[model samples]
Target: MQNTSHLLMIRPVKFSFNEQTAVNNAFQQNDTNNNVAEMAAREFDAFAQKLQANGVDVTIVEDTPEPYTPDSIFPNNWISFHEDGNIILYPMFAVNRRAERKPHVLKAIEKKFRIQNKIDLTALEANHQFLEGTGSMVLDRDHKIAYACLSPRTHMSALNNFAEKTGFTTVAFHANDRNGLPIYHTNVMMCVADQFVVVCMESITDENEKKLVRDAIHKTDKSIILISFHQMEHFAGNMLQVQNNRGEKLLIMSTQAYESLTADQIKILENYNRIIHSSLNTIETNGGGSARCMLAEVFLPVQQTQ
Candidate 1:
């Protein structure tokens, strides 16, 4: 399925601005407020509640305080659950971020879902090669395509390896921000939902690469919702589409992202699904991630319960 009704969220305990990730993640701001952790925890609870209110299944696990993973709230970077009963663990770019992949977290999930296989790519960290799960590639699950904006965190070798293992075709390109710095993660610049994609076209300066990406999206039979650099800055492109228990599609985004959209863009997107946005200013500002990053879609098969 392109969208999952179930999700996995990690409630942050030591939530703060991650210095290790800020090196390439231009979106992170140095949150000076001493109550940063408290504010982030509240924002996380609200976001999860918003999803639950919409009938989406959410399994939230508290981050272990023993190892400080400041960016642990954004679990999409380290793990992605597949419908084929596979749980793929990705190689993280930041050393601190690596600790976010916790075995107990998966054990918590296993109580509700069955894991048939494990695709462990963390070994690539030994080679200093990385592909940070869905953050590195915006997957078109329905079309079996992985759209990627190659950067320091997303490498060709890892993408190829993933494709070889998962039967996905990778459409890779280079994308940069206003100052010509590489976009840290593909999810920041583009989001592939069930029926439409929100993307920052201006970021893909290479005309040929832009066309290639558009053509690839067209092949997947998805409408491309173009977002400007300004909107992208507000996390507009960082959206995800998920289904509720009633099978209604809901487009999830941060309030910052929703407010940034033009009326026309909003109309176009609502044509496909209902918009569900909540305030995530604190999380987005300090975490360098938005709603999409906070959610790790769980497509695993449900465990049989007697």
Candidate 2:
């Protein structure tokens, strides 16, 4: 299956704008208007409930309160599950984010799912190299391609290693924020769906790189939904497609992202799937990650019925 109905989300016990992550992620700010941790917990709880109400099977886990890892709610950045029964654990740039990769979580998941192989890329962090999982690279599963934009948090070496291990082609490009600094995460500017790709092509200043990325998407027979740098900044491209309980396709995004869409864009997307969104103002304001970043799809098949 290209998408999963099952999703894993962490309820933030201590969520806030991580000062450590803000070094690379300029989108985050330490502000009092959004009382950091309290607001995040409320938003996360609402977001999870919204997903579940939409018929999504969400596995909610409470984040440990002691360590105070603010970004723990966005679990997709730390781990990903594959259909081949493989699980890949990624190296996180933030010190607290590294703590999000707990063995107990995987063990808990193992009780319901079969994990054939486990690949750990956190070792790269020891060498000062990092790749923040789905945040760093958008995977085109059917085509076996990993679309990534080189940034401070996304290391090229780690991307290459992932490509080699997964037998995926890497389409790496440089993307910058409005101020021209490298964007912290690729998912913030792009998303790869089964038959479509939404991206901020303008972020790639290099003509050659932009063309290469465009050509790669075209080669996959996927329709390109282009979003301007301005739209991308509003988290328009940061969307995820998932299956609902009735086996229906649903595209999930933040309410901010939904409002940013044009009538034509919404119509085009609706042709592919149902759209589901929720108000994540506090989460987006503090965490600098939207709905897509919070979900880690479990593509592994369920155990057979007796």
Candidate 3:
């Protein structure tokens, strides 16, 4: 299944500007407001409510305040829940971000979801190689293909390692922002849903690799909606498609991202699924991530009754 109704989100306790992630993530801003955390929590709550009201299953976990992990709201970077009852712990790039892997987080998830194998990739952090889970790779799960854009935060070694262990063929490429700096994470510029893919083709710089990426998605029989670099900056590329309990497909994105889309683009996307967007300006400004980053898709099987 490409889309999952179940999602895991961390309700922020210390959500604010992350200095460590700001060095590479161009999307983050420090001068957002004085009360960043409060506004972020409100936005989080609203987004979660909207998703749940639409029949999406959300498992909300409260974040610990002690660690001072300002970017913990974006949990997709550290852990991924898979369909085979496997959970993968990834090695994060920022030193402070590494503290997000608290054991209690997993324990909380285990109560509702049955996890079979625990794949720990944190050992790679010692060698300065990081993958940052799904943030580094936009996965086409139904086709068993991984689309990755390499950067300091997304190392080739870690990509190969994940491919080796998961049996997902990798389509690796390099991408840069409009300013010519490498984009920190692949999810910032691309999203692979079941029927189609949303991507910033301008960011791919290399023509050959761009063609390869297009061919890969085409081979999988998915339509492509090419987003401009300007649209990408507004997080138009960070959308995620998810199924509801009623088996309806819905495309999710931040309000900023939805407003940035062109009529044609919106029309194309609407043909595939209903679009659900929420205001996330505060979280987007401080955390440097949007709606998709806040959601870690929970693909693990539900705990059966006795």
Give the deviation of candidate 1 from the true structure as CA RMSD: 0.7
Query: What does candidate 3's lDDT look like per residue over 181-229, in tens digits?
Result: 9999999899999899999999999999999999999999999999999
Cα misplacement distance, residue 300 of candidate 3 (Å): 0.6
Off by over 4 Å in 3: none
**How much is 162 displaced in model 2, in angstroms?**
0.8
lDDT of 2 by residue, 57-144 (tens): 9888778877667788899899999999999999888887888987667876786778899998989998888988899999888888
lDDT of each: 0.94, 0.87, 0.94
Cα error of candidate 1 at position 190, Å: 0.8
Q: Give me the displacement of residue 224 in model 1, in angstroms.
A: 1.0
Whole-model lDDT, model 2 = 0.87
Residue pairs clashing in model 2 are none
Clashes of each: 0, 0, 0
- Among all windows of 10 consecutive residues in model 1, the one with the lowest summed lDDT is 188-197
Identify the superior model by TM-score, candidate 2 or candidate 3: 3
Overall local distance difference test of candidate 1? 0.94
